[model samples]
Target: MHTSSARDAARIRVCHIVHSGKVGGVEVAAALLQAEQHPSINYQVAVLAQLPDGEPQAIKAPDCVGHGLNNPLSVLPVLKWLHRNAPDIVVASLWRSVLVGMVAKLINPKRKFVIFLHNTQYKNVLDRAAHRLGFRLADGIFCDAPATRQAMTAELPLETGQIHVVPLVARGGRSRHTPEAEQGPVGAVAGGEIRCVFWGRLAKQKRLDRAVHLLAELNNRATVPVRLDLLGPDEGELDEMLRLARSLGVEQQLHWHGAADWGRIRDVASGASFFIQLSDFEGLGMAAVEAMQLGLVPVVTPVGQIAEFTSDGVNALHFDSAAPVAERMLSVVGEPPMWERMSAAAVAEWSGQEDLSTAFETVCRQFLANQQANAANHVIRGAVS
Candidate 1:
């Protein structure tokens, strides 16, 4: 089964390549999955950019190498490194990594190149062109959301069967046996305030501003206080988002956690009962998934993978991205009892998903196994010929 201790039996090595080891959903997912990957699979990472300051060093791939992301010739060095080592399978994540994988595959044809797109792809004419190029280069295609898979497969002259749709990897699988009603610290919610949390980069796609507006909405109708804690690296828009939050008078209620790693964010989120995500779209939000793992109910608009994980009146409160953001927030957590039930449901639904590490490990082994079978078939056919 290629368990964590089955390394002695492993016949293949897998390398995961990402654009950076910075504090974001994709980077964090890569790190968490890497940690959980089975020992039997020689798991490694190739980071394409320098590790940002304050991000956990452990998140970087083991024996990982990085090429300065801004440098045009970055691919050449990475391509050379991968060529030298020649991992059995190279799973490249995000856009840059996909390009890196495509180039590296040209030099090492036998090496399986899997392009893992973990975000809502913005496809223009240029993007579609690159998609075609990626399709031509990839041995396997993985998209974090069904929409992403559709985008990759639709209008592209490629084998759609190769595309595999899955959520952003789920991390920290815990015993879901804890009754939802009694999941968090005792008396944590007695005050009637829903301690809400949000974690992600301060980018337009994340719609941090929309998230703040949602908080203002929740606060307006709250029986008590509803505080929002946003934890992530500030990618220059934190000030603008903060101004928006201030404009709404939620500056006091909004806690801007400029930049933080997973450990600190998770630790801080322990006190939070709800996770807020009102992004325009997401690939598969690792932040939202991590919060769900901790039993926090997600109140996210149905966009990208959010639709796949969240169900209205069920596990999560789904809102229209185009609707009044605050009005939607009010519906999700206005009633304390409703919030409690939703929280439990969120944990339950999250637990139903495959463990992040296990899912990644399975994917790696599947690629290697398929490669082996194809090789054996080629040999058999050669002898017959």
Candidate 2:
């Protein structure tokens, strides 16, 4: 119901297309951006896959569209939808969505397309080709981290001018910490319960097995008892990680809480003293940021844009995947003062300048300005003709 000025009446219509409507950091980010878009802009969302009946949905974008395409020819419906909607700009949030957007742009050459890079690495040949084609056809590119921006330019041979490094907006505010007394009768630490938390999908790329191994090694060396709380959705590699933990004889020290709701995940994180992310590569490390916000010192691999928000011995404790991860974790666990210092720094980092609202507004204004310029050029050309 918001309106714009006469000069701003040419509202930029933006559509965010993603592969799935399921809940995750990327989906949450898209939903946040959609909800926070300026009144002058027209926003819509389209998911390549449809959500099931009675599933809890988080998207607030005005006009959510879905295409239930299960086959190779399923892309046709998406292309047709794009043509019919004819948005002034389309932003694809994932690889498959990028491919759909590229084809849609190819069919309707007048519309502009943009790709938002959310992952740290790209390997699929089809996805790479589609991304390249999309880049060639896109008017601009938005990356969630500076490292990602650099990698994309190096990998695709694109100019720096075309790529923009817009860091991921922190979706949640400061988290409330739970006191030790309020932890709800969890076992005493005397039995060797050193609670460690890991949040992300249980996929091979995440290296969940490596995390479990690190926890097992910690338990082996600890004079006191220790336990690891592995929280996330079990996909392809969950069973492997569980079996590895059992084989190492540390299964008792590890607990699988399955995938948790965002609120519950935050609550679980508040009570834990440490968080670990063992991803082979990442774009922005959203969960790490969230964990830091909740006062959990993170022990993470220096991949993707992790170094942007964290530094070794500062906001976070960093470890290289090649080195002894278990040894690195032990060093922090053994030093109480160091752990406390890192936890304080982590909380401070989250409170610093990573405001999502400011970043979202900047991008929208830039998009609107560019659209208006293009419209002015068209008018000038028509007058001349």
Candidate 3:
């Protein structure tokens, strides 16, 4: 697995490690990096957990290796694989992946490890410790949002030079048209029926119950038809959300469409008038970004990097998660002009900067350059020592 001097000019092997092969921000980003084709670099992916049966049909990276590691002990197999393959650089896309990458680097100190911080979740002591250890062991840190980078520096006390802010690459697809380009329903339809679409796992962290309650509140006084479409896998939280919607007497207005295929999901999102994301926290709101790209006016809280891509009055209608979300939703639904402005801005923003190919190439190039420099530094240190 040792590198040959003659191979220096050839493609450098880079491996991306992720916790799961499921559809998420981190996984999508890693897939994009792996799928990128460049003359100077070759990419591979290793997933810690086995992808769900028939769930990963959408992923196009053929070289991605699924280790089927269901637990911490399963990481040993990954370590062995890494030892044999000996990637010039390893990029860990999640916390668990970062831990595994750090351990792999310890096994071979010459290996360069770069960690991508996808979210901001440093609440407990153990989480903080793991984050610090990963920061200290990795050669560089890549962050999608400013908040994530800030959290890393605060917790790890790393020098600013070691932190890199690379925005997440958008999923490639047709650019969604602006409201004017849209054929019908340019704004919130009259009669107060605001069609809001929410797409994500129905997990506790997502706090979809809050959205249900908001719909209930809106139904109390609103004359317009306010409908909410819940799209995602039906986890335990789905039942609870349904109960909440019923209790709020908005059951008739709420539609539950279980997990949809990517194409179907995009079609559903593109047809929606508004997109609502009520998650308490997020590393990067990929669904929100996708919805915005499709001309859906985003009504999201300022959590994670949602604010990074969206301006309060420019592209989205930002709301505090703790504030009167339902009341605000009603207000927006009642004002078609405001909705039109926000929807137009949302489409404009996505069209302007959410180009997946460009963003992916930029991050890949930066990562490869960093890895080359780190490899050279390791060689120099070894010679001196």
Best by TM-score: 1
Say which prediction, candidate 1 or candidate 2, comes out ahead on TM-score. Answer: 1
lDDT of 2 by residue, 82-132 (tens): 667678778887777887777877877777777998776775787778787
lDDT (Cα) of model 3: 0.68
Q: Per-candidate TM vs. native?
A: 0.83, 0.82, 0.81
**Model 3: residues with Cα > 4 Å off, grouped in runs:** 1-9, 36-40, 56-69, 123-127, 172-192, 234-236, 321-337, 354-361, 367-385
Q: RMSD per prediction, one decimal?
A: 4.4, 5.1, 5.0
For model 1, what is the error of residue 35's alpha carbon versus the real structure, in angstroms, after optimal superposition? Answer: 1.6
Clashing pairs for model 2 are 192-225, 192-226, 193-225, 194-226
Q: By TM-score, how accurate is candidate 3?
A: 0.81
lDDT of each: 0.68, 0.69, 0.68
* lDDT for each residue of candidate 1 in 160-246, tens digit (9 for 90 to 100): 245666456444344222235533321124255667788778777777777777777777766678788888777777889889888
lDDT: the better of candidates 2 and 3: 2
Q: Model 3 over residues 1-385: C-alpha lDDT tens digits?
A: 6466455446667777886666666666665655544435666777777656666433444344445544777578777778777887788876677788889888888887888787777646765677678877887787877877765566565543456777663552332322244422223443535677887777777788778876777677667677888777655797788787788788898887776555566666654677878778876777787777666778887788786888886777776652466666566656777777777777676554644434544565676676677668879999999
